[model samples]
Target: MAMTAGVLALVLCVLCFAGFWLGRQEAVRIRSGGVQPHSLPSYYGSYVALVCGIPASLALLIWISAADSLVRQFVIAGLPDHLSALPEGDLALLLTDVRNMAYGRVPLNTARPEIVGAVEHYLRLGEISRWLMWLVVLALAIGGLLLGRRMVSAEFRARNAVEQILNILLIASSTVAVLTTIAIVLSLIFEALRFFAKVPVTEFLFGLTWSPQTALRAEQVGASGAFGAVPLITGTMLISVIAMLVAVPTGLMAAVYMSEFMPGRLRAVVKPVLEILAGIPTVVYGFFAALTVAPLVRDAGMAIGLNVASQSALAAGVVMGIMIIPFVSSLSDDVLNAVPNSLREGSYGLGATQAETIKLVLLPAALPGIVASVILAFSRALGETMIVVMAAGLAANITINPLDAVTTVTVHIAALLVGDQEFDSAKTLSAFALGLLLFVVTLTLNVIAQRVVKKYREQYE
Candidate 1:
């Protein structure tokens, strides 16, 4: 069916192209006879092509989406009475096995006769559906092409029609984007509400213990869960603070140098090389943190007569900071460069030194963007999981000290959902609660950043 659909799409594309060519040629032939077209030849072509393709494409999509369900119904209706009378859940499972066997994903040798007959019926119905889909879609395409060609006169207003269609398409795309975001937020809210029902909001928000192990059976030992989330929140802040401390100053200085002082040739070379850090995979950074930075941090702490865990927040934070440097530097560099040279000249006109002018004038002017970049970097730090998982152990310790093993909300969220488990269980549903918390925190940060930016922007502008 997939192959048939692909072929149908290719055929529709070729027909649309033919419509475009014929429409364009007709407009040119009219112009050769000295009649001015209502729009450009290209507009005429686009109108015909869109008319030819749109109906066919929509029909094809609807057909393919409905085919499987229609085929399933037909096959089930033809099933023997005993099989058809099974409970909905059991019937669904039986259909799944039938599909697997039909697709050769499972052995058919042990299959019962009714199951074999159902599989054959399913395949036959699917094949008929594919043929009907092709005929209906192609007929629509041909009809649309003829109708469009007949409408393409010198007064057809093809450009206005094309632009109207494009506007509708753009609005639809934007609507889909907005709808998708709403759907995601709604899903998170619903699932998190389920979790909150199982665990109280106050305990989740303020509880210090972080263990989420629930007993599978009544006799299991030490499986009573603690859903307190304070420790996870504390660990997240510890790592993110450390990361920002490392990233902000280093990245800001690099941005300042690149935008203001560095030679153009050297800046060109250094910028791409620095940005390359952002391209390296996070898992690779995790491996580097575990094998290289963690041991180094442990050794350094020991040499200073201090205790540090083998997997500590400090190692993860520092590595995460290094990873986000490019994000900060790239944005800050663009912002700094956007600061008008006239501002620099005005400061220099008053005999301000280069360092002093940058400190007072350029920095103030670019403050909003700089703040935005730092906030972005902080968000990046907060969301980091692999580095934390590999270098910072999932201990969920509520210590301010970076040398302690810790875990972020993201790490715990991932840990909670890693293996097979009951979806209704608090252990699994807790991941959604953590996700909601993270979303709220991120949204709050964005609001704060916007307020700060708005204040500074009004002053600068």
Candidate 2:
């Protein structure tokens, strides 16, 4: 189906271009006959292209989205009554097996006769669905082309029509983005609520212990699991604070030097090289933290008579700060550079030195943006998982000390959802609760940052 959709997209592109050429030539031919074209030749071409592509693309999208559920329904309907009447979980697994067999993921020879028959039926339905989709889509495209050609008279307002369609498309794209965000929030809320139903909200929020293990059988030992989130919250804050301590001064100073002191030619060369840190994958940073920084931190701690765990929050936080340096420096650089030169001139004209002007004038003016960049970097640190997982062990220790092994909310979120398990269980549902907590914390941070930015902005402006 994906291949067919790709081919159909290529075909539509060719057809739309053909429609464009035909419409443009028609408009030109009409103008040559002394009837002035309604809009530009390009507008006429665009009108034809939009007409040829939009309807067919919408149809193809609808068909592809609905195909899977329709296939499953048909396959299930063809199954024997006993097989079809299984519980929802069993039925879902049966359908998965049917799909696996149809796709050759499972060997058919070892399967039951009914399963084999269902696989055959699944293939047949899928083939029919694909062929029908192709036919309907192409027919709509060709029909739209003919209609668009007929409508391309001198009186037709091609530009207005085209612009209206484009406006609608833009609105639709925005709506999709907004809806996706809402959907994510709603899903997290619903699942978190389920987790809360099983584990008391107060206990999960304030309890000091962080175990999430639940026994499989009634007779199993250590069945009751503690779901206190304070430890995870503390670990997250500890690492993030350490990261900010490293990132803020370093990144802000780099920004200050580059934007103010460095020559323009040197700035141009250095800024991109500095921002390249942002492009390096987080896993590589994780590796550096685990193999290089962790050991160095341990040795340095030992050298000073401090007992540092091999996998400690200090290593993760430091590497995470390094990773976030570009986010801070690049934004801060732009913000500092954006401060009007008039302010600097005024400060200098008043007998202030360069350093004094930077301290009293430039930094004050760019405080809002600088704050924003630091907040962005802090958010990046809070959400960092790989470096924490590799450099800081998953102990969920409720400690403020950077030398201790700890885990953040994101690391545990990854841990909780790693293996195949029952989604309804408290162990799995706890991930959603953690996600909700993280979301609230981030949203709170943004709100605080906004208020700070607004207050400073008002005073400065």
Candidate 3:
């Protein structure tokens, strides 16, 4: 079908070009006869090309989209009522078998007449559909070509028609993007609601314990479990805060020096070296944290008479921050560099030193972009999992102490869905609840960032 479609597309392209040539020559001959056209000869040719291609492509898309489901229904009609009434999973497997047989991917048993007949019908219908598409599409392309040529005249508004079609295409693309976002949010909401139904929303939101184990029977020991999300939330915030503390000032100051003070050659060398941090795999960062940094942190803590777990939040967070530095520095450096040199020059004209000028002028001008970059870096730190899993042990401890082992929302979610899980289980469903909570937090941060950006933008621009 794909090959056939490609062939049809090639044929249509050739015919559209033919129509363009004919229409263009016609317009030229008319213009030579002293009749002025509303548009150029090329515009008339383009209009004919659009006529030949657009409607034909649209019909092809519509037919391909509907063909599979319609053909499946036709095949299912010939199957036994027992097969039709089978459980969804069983019916799905049967459908797969039938499709495999139809495609000669499976050896069909001569003993089953109904299955054989259904496979034959499915293949036959597919063939008929392909032929039907080829005939109808080619016919439409020829008809559209003639109509476009007949409509071509001195007064035709070919450009206007093309523009309207372009506007519709733009609107359709935007609608799809918005619809996709809505679909994601709706799915999360539905699943989270299912989770909340089984576990009380209040308990899940405010409970301090983080166990999610449920036993198979009431006679089992430790059958019931706690689902408090406070520890996960607190641990996420703790690691993210530590990461920001490491990333923000360092990344920002690096950006400032590179964009403002460094020589061009040094700046070129250092910037790439720093960005190399971002390119190194997170798993590498994880292993580094686990084997190298975690031990170092433990030794440093003991030497200073402070107790620190080998897999502590500090170890994970410091490594995670190092991973995120490039995100901040690259974006901030670009933002600061993008600030018009005119602004800096104006400050110098007022007898401002380079340092003072940057503090009072360039920073303010680039504030919006800096804030956006920091927010992006913060989001990355919040979502980081591998380093946390490797360096910070999966203990949901609600402590702010960086020396303590802790787990984050992402780690918790990953833990909950680690193996084959029943979707209806509160244990599995809790992942959705945690996801919803994380999403809301992220959404809130985005809102705050947008407000900050808007306020500073009005002042700067």
Best by lDDT: 2
Candidate 2: pairs in clash: none
* Candidates ranked, most accurate by TM-score first: 2, 1, 3
What are the Cα lDDT values of the candidates?
0.91, 0.91, 0.88
lDDT of each residue in 111-156, candidate 1, tens digit only: 8888888888887887789889999999999999998888788888
Q: Please give the lDDT score at residue 163 for candidate 3.
A: 76
Per-residue CA lDDT of model 2 for 10-115, tens digit only, reads: 9988999999998888888888899997898889988998999999999989998999899999999999999999988889999999898888888999998999
| Lowest lDDT 10-residue stretch of candidate 1 | 215-224
Of the pair 2 and 3, which is ahead by lDDT?
2
Ten-residue stretch with the least lDDT total in model 2? 215-224
Q: Which one wins on TM-score?
A: 2
User: What is the TM-score (0 to 1) of candidate 2?
Assistant: 0.93
Better of 2 and 3 by TM-score: 2
Model 1: how far residue 63 lies from native, Å: 4.6
**Per-residue lDDT of 1-461 in model 3, one digit per residue for the tens?**
67777888899889899989978888888899999988889888888888887898888888888887788888888788977888766677787888899877899885288788888888898899899999988898999999999988998877787678778879998999999989988888999999898899999989999999852332334454789999999999999999999999899999999999899999989999999999999999999999999999999999999999989999999999888889889999998988888889999999999999999998988999899889988888888889999999899998999999999999988888876556777787898899899889888888888988888873335
